[model samples]
Target chain A: MNVEQVRSAVLKLSVHNDAVLSEQGPHCPGSETLDIRHFGGEESIVRPAVTDMHFPEVVFPTSRVGRVAGLEKVRELVVEHHRLIWHSPLQPIFGGNEKHFWKAVELTADFHAEVCGGPKLYSERKGHPHLRERHFPFTIREKDRELWLDLYVQALRNVAFPLEVAEEYWRWVESLSIRMINRRTTFAEPVRVPFNHIAERLA
Target chain B: MNVEQVRSAVLKLSVHNDAVLSEQGPHCPGSETLDIRHFGGEESIVRPAVTDMHFPEVVFPTSRVGRVAGLEKVRELVVEHHRLIWHSPLQPIFGGNEKHFWKAVELTADFHAEVCGGPKLYSERKGHPHLRERHFPFTIREKDRELWLDLYVQALRNVAFPLEVAEEYWRWVESLSIRMINRRTTFAEPVRVPFNHIAERLA
Candidate 1:
């Protein structure tokens, strides 16, 4: 699927109706499901059709993340992600300022690098990373989150992120992105996009 | 009508089920409602039975809040609020360290004073007051928020906060408390306690 198709699918999947899920189960019956194959010959599994309301705690696969890609590549991915966001419809969400945009890219690079076990760059420069609080000034609805994930997918593809740890990295971002949503525009909870569904698209 | 009774009532009111409300309406039919009289001889209104999922932005009544009570009283209220939290079941959530507890009280006092239009003490000392982000480490569930509002109610009553701005102040804290909930322990949204319900009890 193309970026637009992927975006549409992600949005449809993430905002799965709670009423339907409750009557059915965690995996929505008859809803679209993607077969995700695990790396290293593990069993392939079907992506759950619905997401729980719980905002999960992301435990970064620091070792694998750092081993697969160095700091430079990580920085490149961060820059690419920002570039995608800047060029997308969500540009206004970042306040439409070039200086602020680049500054955000720099800070985000530092944060991503630190989270991936590169170095203590973010904390040393900016103190504790209270990310949710920092993003409070912006109004991030559920749709914005889907757009964000779409852009990130493009970034990962653009940078040719190693598939060895791509799923792990995808899981991190997928869960972490939910926490950034400060505003609620819908009764539906944010959707979850398993890496398998995007893996083929990225390839 | 004592603090304990008030706490129980607030807890019961705030956790009003969503299924029940949806079947009924915004104001839960047959649910207990409280009569709240306005300060300036306006009509007394009944408290709504349920709270929406939206986390409201607190607009401080700077003029009235500052006029009715000065910086000293605001500080006292902040300190008293923290004192109550420390003495209550929620004390452990503050890390059980006396030094950290007092430091939080000081910072909070600065924030409260500034928000009440006293001075920019908090922003001067600490860069910005990201209340939600700062509380990220704490597991602030819906019930925790209820307890917090309970204590704040007690603090307001104990300090004899001027009824002139009591409703305004209550609305601010009541809504602001929802923003601090980082964890979701239940499917139910946080309950809202209208000032009228507690006003009679406080009096």
Candidate 2:
């Protein structure tokens, strides 16, 4: 589909989202953005990279509601707690070729550990995914990297994990995000601003 | 959103649909003209609805393909069985209360029985939705009714319902769509149509 069509589909999915758009906006630790919108009729533009981001809410389809509500808190918390660290600037970028440098970070095992509610879901599913080591094959463009982050956000955003419970989780995501990137040796853009110390680039 | 925004959203959603604007247009059953801009995004001020329409192969979302494959043979057919019926000419203008009238009919128990595979799902948990009696309290306004229909199309389109195995089931959905309304006595212009005969306008 062209960019506009993609945006239209995303918006349609967003409009009746009683399942995902709980209480108006979504909060995650270290999510990327894929802002979809229409310039005119039917056609859409997708800004697939996320910066200082927040998931504004829309109505979710009904079927998803039960699934979100039904998730075990421990597993939910496990995912949320890592959000902050994942988005942190202190971490190093992934060093080699990769589709999503951040996703390649060796952090999911740790993220699952924080879930405490249901840690076994991850540990038993697979021991651990080595980060930098596993990402040496795919070509990672800036756009592709951003898209990976966007998808990660999507995976986490739809399942409601509450505000207070989710905030701390976000912090962990931010922290882990810094460690996911290995491009510190080459590119010098998309300035990584610190969480609490996010600087205003404009007057 | 304001009326203009709502209208724009409608225009975008309808016009941007890939299935409606393919090289092979309006071949699917139940397809209707909607001033949709065809591929190549050329601006078109007006285009009429076709009586019958089908979705393009790629228009089906990846998520839907997996779901449609799992539905029982009958449930799968509910997507577009009665194009001949819904395609029939109607006194009411297209996009008029006809679609609204559709939402109303589908809210009935009798209409539910006739459709191939739908009778069980609606009442399985919610019980018989005393549609006419319940609708007495609510008169859906012109705009709300239109939006309501739009919402249904968004929710129901393709929806993983299989092809012919689901055809009879779809007839029932089309049938029940008429029962959703309770406007028994009206002096409104544009003669009202029977719920049962809706299949005629849809093909």
Best candidate, TM-score-wise? 1
lDDT per residue for candidate 2 within B1-203, as digits (tens), equals 63333543554455334343343232322123321212112221222222111111111012222234443432322323222224422112122355655553344322233222223444443342333223322322223333344333333343433442233333323333333332211112112223234333333
DockQ of each: 0.02, 0.01
lDDT of 1: 0.62
Q: CA lDDT of each candidate?
A: 0.62, 0.31
Model 2 Cα lDDT, one tens digit per residue, A1-203:
63333433444454334333333333211112312111111222222222221111111112122233333543443354334334432112222333344353334533343232222334343333222222222122233344444433443454444433333333334333332332211112322323233212110
The true-versus-predicted C-alpha distance at residue A78 of model 2, in Å, is 10
Model 1 regions lying over 4 Å from their true place: A1-53, B1-203
- lDDT, candidate 1, residue B85? 91
What residue pairs are clashing in model 1?
A14-A191, B14-B191
Model 1 per-residue lDDT tens digits across residues B1-203? 54433543454344343333234332322123321111111221222222224464443445457667876888898898888998887876676579968987898887777666666676666543444535544445577889899998899989988888788667777876776675543335578898988998678
